[model samples]
Structures are given as C-alpha cells and as structure tokens.
Target: MKRPLLFLVACMIAQLSFAQSKDEKAVAAAVENMRKAMIDGERTALENLADSRLTYGHSSGLIEDKPTFVEHIASGGSDFVSIDLLDQTITVAGNTAIVRHVLHAATNDNGKPGKVALKILLVWLKEGGEWKLLARQAVKEPAK
Candidate 1:
C-alpha cells in the first residue's frame, strides 16, 4: 500500500509541474493556429487571428497594420514554407498575454527560397472569448 501511494503522489507532482493555466494554454493554442495559418496562407484564418488594430513590425524595420499584414501573408507575398517555434514562453496577465519565442523558418518570398531565424515577441488580447494578436515584433537573431 505504501509503495503504490508514493508512486501515485510522485506522478501527481510531475503532472502538476507540466500543467498550464487555462489562459496560458489558450494563448499557446492561438499562437500555433497563427503559425499554421501563416504557413498555409489561409486568408480567413489570418484575418480572424489578427485584432482590428494590430501593429506588426518586422526585423527589417518594416511596419504594417492589420489589413496590410493579413493581405501580404494571405496573398503569399510573405510566404513561409515552414515555421519552427523554439524556446517559447507565455505569460498571461488578465486578458493579455505576452509570448516570446525563437522562430526559425524556411521561406519562399516572391519565388526566392531563403531561411531566417528571428526572436519574436507577440502580444495577444482575449476578445469575444477568443485570443487575437494585438501586436507582434521580430528581430533577427544575433550570430553565435
């Protein structure tokens, strides 16, 4: 009996350490959905994911509003062949979430294939029971 009880408690502790809060999980899911939409050039999904007043900034110092951002991605002007998000961390405070990650991507922009590595910061807001991207900024990763 003691051995089984100790094993159960240990498993419970492990599970607790891996568990995320409801909001945190939601934000993570939202981030994943956005990534998929970007790769697939899903116009509707990209539009829905972005807040009405989104401010998107690129590592090149280009800034775009919601309409421009969605249009560029959906039209395949900003095409992503694949995206990998690494070392991601999410923090939720009230209805806002701040997400940081290292993004490595294979891209084919206007028919030229390329690769990029960037550090990304995203701000999400919970609106109408859904997480929407309010802002995002990216910076090129420094040489190792």
Candidate 2:
C-alpha cells in the first residue's frame, strides 16, 4: 500500500512539472511573438497579442492603454532596428504568468537613432486557450 501511494505521488509530481514547463514555453512564445510584432510594426498582431485592459508602462514613466500602445507602434513613432532579449525567466501561476527579461535594442524614434537597454517585466494571462499580454513595465538599465 505504501509503495502504491509513493508511486502515485511521484507521478503527480512529474505531471505537475511537465504542465509548468508547457505553460512556460507557451508564455515565452507569446512574448517572442509580441517582440516580433513590435519589430515589424505589425499593429494587428500587436493588438491581438495584448489584452484590452493592457497597461504598458515605459521606462520614461509614461503609461499607455491598449489603444494608445497600438497606435504608437503603428504610427511609426518608434521603429526598432533590432531587439535582443537576455536573461529571460518565466514563472507560471495558474492562469497567469510573469516574465522578466533584459532587452537591448537599436531604435529610431522619429528619426533620432539610439540604443537602449532595459529590464522588462511582463504579465500575461491565459484566455481562450491563448496567452495575452495583460501588462508590461520597463525600467532603463543603468549604464555599464
């Protein structure tokens, strides 16, 4: 009887770990898709990936809602030349996932070229079997 119980516990642990891994992958994919959309200036894709209640906070302390965020990307206000993400970590909690990453990018905003490095925190929620960005906040990384 004790052996059977131990086997059941082990199986449960394995299943839980697998599920977490799967969720983490999905969350990571969602984040990557968003990044690609941002780089491509794909407004529709960006709109689709983000929840309607999204709150996007910029490194400069500016906050934007979903519509404003979409408009800003679509309007060519900021164009990304390249984006490199590093040290990404994703944590899944039920239907919610938190992602932390460092983003380094070359950008041309209104024709002013610059490079930026920031630490980003993204919150995603699973809805209708899809992960959508619910909120994102970024802070400028100190110069090294």
Candidate 3:
C-alpha cells in the first residue's frame, strides 16, 4: 500500500510539472505573436489579440482605446524594427494571466532611428475560449 501511494504521488508530481511547462509555452507563444504584430505594424494581428475593451497605455503616458490604438499603428505612429523579449515572467490564475517582461525595441523615434528599453506589463483574459489582452502598460527605462 505504501509503495502504491508513493507511485501515485510521483505520478502526480510529474503531471503537474508537465502542465506548468505547457502553460508557460502557451503564454510565451502568445506574447511572441503580440511582439511580432507590433514589429510588423500589423494592426489586424494586434487587434485580434486584444479584447474589445482593451485599455492600452504607452510609455508616452498616453492612454488609448482599442480603435485609437489600432489606428495609431496603422498610421505608423509606432513601428518596431526589432523587438527582443527579455526576462519574461508570467503568472496565471484561472482565466487570468499577467505577463511582465523587459523589452528591448529597435525603432525609429519619429524618423530618428534608435533603440529603447521598456518595462512592459500585459494583462490577458481568457474569454470565450480565447486569450486576449485586456490591458497593457509600458514605461520607458532610463538610459544606463
């Protein structure tokens, strides 16, 4: 009986570990898609990932609604040449997930080319069988 109990515990541990790994992978992929959309300036891709009631905040201290945000991207207000996700950490609780990461983005600052580091937080909600970004906040990091 003891041996059987031990085996059951081991099996449970392995299953839990596997589930965690899978969750992490899923979160990473979703975040990557968002980054890719931003880099490519594909407003459609970005819009699809966002909830209809998305509250997006930029490093410039501007807050925009979903349509406004999408239009800005479409109008070339923001474009990323390269985006690197650094030190990402994700915490998931049921249908809600919080993704925080340091982002290194290479882009032209209003026609002046440069790279910038930004600390970003993205809140995602699983709604109607899909995960969508509910809120996003980004703050520019000071130059070292």
Candidate 4:
C-alpha cells in the first residue's frame, strides 16, 4: 500500500512539473513576441500581446495604460534599436506567469540615441487560450 501511494505521489509530481514547464515555455514565447513587436514597431502585434488593461511602468517613474503604451511605441517615442534580454526567469501559477529579466538595449527615442540597462518584471495572464501581458515595470540597473 505504501509503495502504491509513493508511486501515485511521484506521478502527480511529474505531471505538475510537466505542466509548469509547458506554461513557462508559452510565457517565454509570448515575451519574445512582445519584444519582437516592440523592436519592429508593430503596433497591432503589441496590442494583441497586451491585455486591454495593461499597466506599463518605465524606469523613469512614468506609467502608461494600454493605449498610451501602444501609441508611444507606434509614434517612435520609445524606439528600440536593439534589445538583449539576459538572465530571464519565468514562474507560472495557474493562469498567471511572472517573468523577470535584465534588459540591455540601444534606443533611439525621437532620434535621441541612448542605451539602457534595466531590470524588468513582467506579469502575464493566460486568458481565452492566450497569454497577454498584464503589467510590466522596469528599474534602471546599477553599473557593474
């Protein structure tokens, strides 16, 4: 009886692990798509990736809603020349995912060239069989 109970428990654990791994991969893909859209200035793609009630917070303490964030990206207000995400981690909790990463990017915001290194946290929610970015926040990383 004990052996059977242990086997059952192990199988359940394995199933949970597999499910989490699958969810993590999906979340990572969603994040990558969002990054690609941002780099390409694809407003429609960005909108699709983001939830209708998105809260985007910048390193400079500015916060934007979904429409404002999409408008800024579309109008070249926050143009990313190149973005490199490093040390990314994703955690899935049921239908929600939390992602953290270091972002190093070369940016040209309205032709003002600049570089930024930031620690970013993103919240994604799985809704209607899709993952959408619900919130994101960035903080400037200290020079190393």
Index of the highest-lDDT prediction: 1
**Which residue pairs show backbone clashes in model 2?**
none
lDDT of 1 by residue, 23-98 (tens): 9999999999999999999999999999999999999999999999999998889999999999999999999999
Candidate 2: regions farther than 4 A off:
1-20
Error of 3 at 6 (Å): 10
Candidate 1 or 2, higher lDDT?
1
Candidate 2 has an lDDT of 0.93
Instruction: Put down candidate 4 lDDT per residue, 81-135, tens digits, no spaces.
Output: 9899999999989999999999999999999999999999999999998999999
Give candidate 1 misplaced runs (Cα > 4 Å).
Answer: 1-14
**TM-scores for all predictions:** 0.91, 0.86, 0.82, 0.87
Q: How far is candidate 1 from the true structure (C-alpha RMSD, Å)?
A: 1.8
State the TM-score for model 1. Answer: 0.91
Total backbone clashes of candidate 2, pairs 3 or more residues apart or in separate chains: 0
Name the candidate, 2 or 4, with the larger lDDT value.
4
